[model samples]
Target chain A: MKRILFAFIVVLVSVSFAKNASAQSEEELVQICGMIAKDATFLKDFRIKLDAGDPPPVQRVPVILKKDVKYRFSVCNSKDFEGKVVLQLFDNNRMLATTYVIATGKDYPTIDWVCTKTGAYHLFFSFRDGKAGLAVGLLSMVEMM
Target chain B: MSRRLLYILLVLVVTASVSSCKSCSNSDDLSQDLVVPDSIAFNDPVPVLGETVIEEMMQNIASPVETAALIKGLKVPFNKDFLLTTKASEKFNTSFEKSLALGIYGCDLGYLNMYEKSSFVIDYIQVIKRLADDIQVGQFFDFSTLKRLATNNENLDSLVTISQQSFSRIDNYLRESNRPMLSAVIVAGLWVEGSYLTTRVAQVSNHKRIRETLGEQKTILIFLLKVLKVYEKDPSMAKFLTDIEKVKALYDDVKITYEVGEPEMVEEDGVIVFKQTDKQIVEMSDETYQKIIDSIQKLRADLTKF
Candidate 1:
């Protein structure tokens, strides 16, 4: 009986710690972003959260890009979320750059893009396999030409 | 033993249920807690865009730093004459007025920070803090840290980054609190001040890049008008909208045409750098550009009135 009680308590404690370790808030995401965006001018940050569903929808953020400017797109995903963030920068129908490379099944934490044209660009965010994801996307200006 | 086991099972079930519920709602609780006061009614007879879309537009507004950087790059001397007087902040009584002044001062602060004018920076920061406090968004600005950073010339980059973050945070907070109207006003104020500074400089310097930059604002002004028009029913915003519409009238003549070009991607230091062959062609007569400058100046003067 004592062994049973000890086993249940251990399970509960482990479960509690696991949950605490995984859950990440926006404040935490901002802290993560501070390190990633160091030495760069931060323009804005997008906080993204999507609940688990049969088909998760992609989140799109629109930004104005100027010519001859270098921009850094940095993303940090929550540990609690199984879905790895796939961020794509699009200008109308043209796909400029993405964080996830499908060819090698590789992912990157940042996409450093230089805008050669001045216009509206959209950032589309989703997770691999349409799974629910929580993350933050930070846009910063690295250089201006 | 069975009773004790049953108790453990009940406890486990309750704990699991509670924890799961808490985890699911952790992201949105603060936004829910912000209750809009009964004073200002947002009964939009014709809501142009949803709250979420307006919030996105607010995020996309060009940072004042970008304009200031471009102005500095043009070698235009940092003219303190162009900035709004910090003493004028006291004249803004209403939240609407305070929010707008907050953004106006924010743009001046960015300009000051860009030029690394540490001497005049403290006054603008203090006024910004006062205006932000008046509107309940003061929490975002770390006044002491900003002050300390302002004193040291070496911390220019840090000062700009932190101030940008603070303004962004205030914007996000306003949207989260369901006060997007205020957010729109703040953005408009920032844009107005930024345009005033640019157009004033353009009036004197007549630089091609400055003129091109002013022309680019045609698109930004259109987007801003869309956001501001949503709050037209509010008495205070009605006058603001009317004044801005006059500015927009001038922008209608500024033509921006885009040429399609392919984008090239190059890897620099293990990171992908994208270059586009596409280009935007801005066309505007000198007369029309002058008209825009005059209209923007008029609008800014009315906005900054005591």
Candidate 2:
């Protein structure tokens, strides 16, 4: 009887704590996504949640990019894991731009690329050191001057 | 009682407690008895539109900002008559109509916000909430917060952003969570209404940019039709598909050709950027443009009315 009671208590407490933790993290990511989009004129980001684990999977979003349009892509994650995730833009196997670099100390937070060719392009994202985190990718047009 | 009998009693108590707690939470979510469809039968999974097609299609949306900016630049008078009526809110009783109406009013909300018409914004917010509530996605919108924002003209940008975010969040949830039928219907509502608003403006203004902007909706409609086709098995969706097919046929002859231009390096907000130079030329004759406008107007009027 005592063993069952103890097991029930543990399970109840674990579920409660897990629920709160998940809610807080999800809430924080949503706030960050809104902040990133506030000033963007054209690009609206699709807020996505990712977890870090072994055999890290990159968050890949594929879309068609039109020729002769300047698209600006920016990312903002939870402060706990800022500068810890890398975001890359790809066309087929060709790497277009990314947010992080080693030994260069140049982490471009937002990547601005002009699609010179009209075709399919990909935005790939993954966390460094398998650190699970929440992130938002914002896309917009460079103002026509 | 025997030990086994006592154990069974304990298990029953625990299960009953958990079930009661879940019901309590569900009730607390919304006071209104929303007909949120719990069992939407589907024959197949929502097909993925070949890599990032959704993401690309999202960006390809006919932004009210562009439409509003052009209308402002042209100094066109704001026409309230062009908007859908509030009385139509009660007509959306089913999940299909409710979801589609939410998107339908979403276009009006954007158009009203962009034109800086603050007075009537809250009315539409209420309609959106009622429709969203009917669809059971009311949780995505903070109604009181949106109502407050709509009343203040200063928050027009925030209002637009919040509403857009709300729609985006719902779209992302439905698509990623494998509920693409609802997503498709909502998107179709938004497009039909948005294109309707743009075409309404184009009818009165001879500006090439507005006409060109409205013409570009052909691309968006093509993508939207592609998404809806995935859910063609649904009976209501089957009916909706026929309407969309009519719009596509009307847009069939409108040609949009892009000419490649060199990338230009420019500095914006102290950051150097490469701007794409390719310009789109929409070869739309007066008759084609007029037909497109007439088709969209008729389609939207019918959809919003019935």
Candidate 3:
């Protein structure tokens, strides 16, 4: 009886976990990315998805930034976690900065950066106390100073 | 019976790790020829792309938007004459040619869309649709909506955004479908065509920024070669890879150097913006630069041949 009860509990937990782990559909993700692209100051190039899953698969992008030009990095999410995902920028292993978190626990929607040194930079994405894949990030260069 | 349960549990654990592991310990050594020197880092030893992560590299691949912005910034005239002719897409009949033609016309569309040349947009959209349909990605496009967005001059960004979203869908679909070689080919076509456009402008205008941009493609070439090397066994892919390898050989002598400097942090709109002070400067001889231009033109012509 105990063994059967344990199996039932396991099945119930997995069903609940799978429900939370569901991914956004392709159409939904594309729309989310398109909405994020609208505000990019420069011709925007890529749309990245961040989910807070079991291990919360962190996404890293390698970008070659040019010197003296300011590039803006922005984050957009589904209505559930729009401003909650953390976007971290790094030069190699060293952490440089992250998106702004307001006093009310909301994050600033975008990060504007200037490249004084031209080299490869890594941008890491994750969620704050949320399920994985809850947010999407948009990368664009703000052409004007 | 006990062992059966153990096997299942072991498989489950292994599957979870493979799906979530972020470390690069699993990557086989990349081709030695494709490695970029520290002064010119182009790739990291990242794992195979996940379905969603595939779009991340779309940004890394030089966007048509970059060429559009460059042309606009240089005050260069919007010359439809400079773009690849729409009918040029019809010349190719094979899956390879059709795939590449899709890429070529796709870049041309980027230029046209950026200029908001309403008249030419439909033709290229038709071309892209035909090619994408040939390639089995037609479902990604929303024809009525794109046309609706295009009719309004102010909807340029939205129209383009929708278009860009389609490309992302292509990447996601290809990755999920386990046909990443096609994805690699599409990206190769996009990069080569975008490079061709830039070099063409550089040929006529001889603008320094354009020239610098052209030279910097050496880095993007490294990135491309790394991706292509993964599919080095496909005969068609092998043939294309060989051609790009030649282009890489042309870039062997072209050098890019970077100088490190103090990083900067600025407050913008209540957000702290961090700036890197490191500078990248390209040094290419007039002779080498010309050689690259000629080589790219010849290579593109060969690839685009029907």
List the candidates' TM-scores in order. 0.86, 0.75, 0.75
lDDT digits (tens) for residues A69-123 of candidate 3: 5666766665544435678888878666677454446566677777654445778
Instruction: Compose the digit string of candidate 3's lDDT tens values, residues B49-73.
Output: 5655553453346567666767777
Best candidate, TM-score:
1
- How far residue A19's Cα lies from its native spot in candidate 1, in Å, is 9.6
Instruction: Judging by lDDT, tell me the better candidate of 1 and 2.
Output: 1
Which residue ranges in model 3 land beyond 4 Å of their true spot?
A1-38, A41-57, A63-70, A77-83, A100-106, A115-120, A129-133, B1-59, B152-154, B269-272
lDDT score, candidate 3, position A18: 57
Interface RMSD of each: 4.0, 6.1, 9.4
Label model 1 with its docking quality class: acceptable
Decoy 3 TM-score against native: 0.75
True contacts kept of 3: 0.28
**CAPRI category for model 3:** incorrect
**DockQ of every model listed?**
0.44, 0.26, 0.22
- lDDT by residue for model 2 (A92-130), tens: 675666666555666655656766544456778787767
Candidate 1, Cα interface RMSD: 4.0
| Per-residue C-alpha lDDT of model 1 across residues B1-306, encoded as one tens digit per residue | 766785976698568758866775765344444444544434554344565775367355757888888888889998999999998888898888988998899999989998999889999999999887777777778788889988766678888888888898888887766677788888988899998999889867978888888888888887788778777887789989888888888888998998887778678877777777777789999899889889889989999885
Comparing only chain B with the true structure, the TM-scores of all models are 0.85, 0.80, 0.79
On a 0 to 100 scale, what is the lDDT of residue B83 in model 2? 83
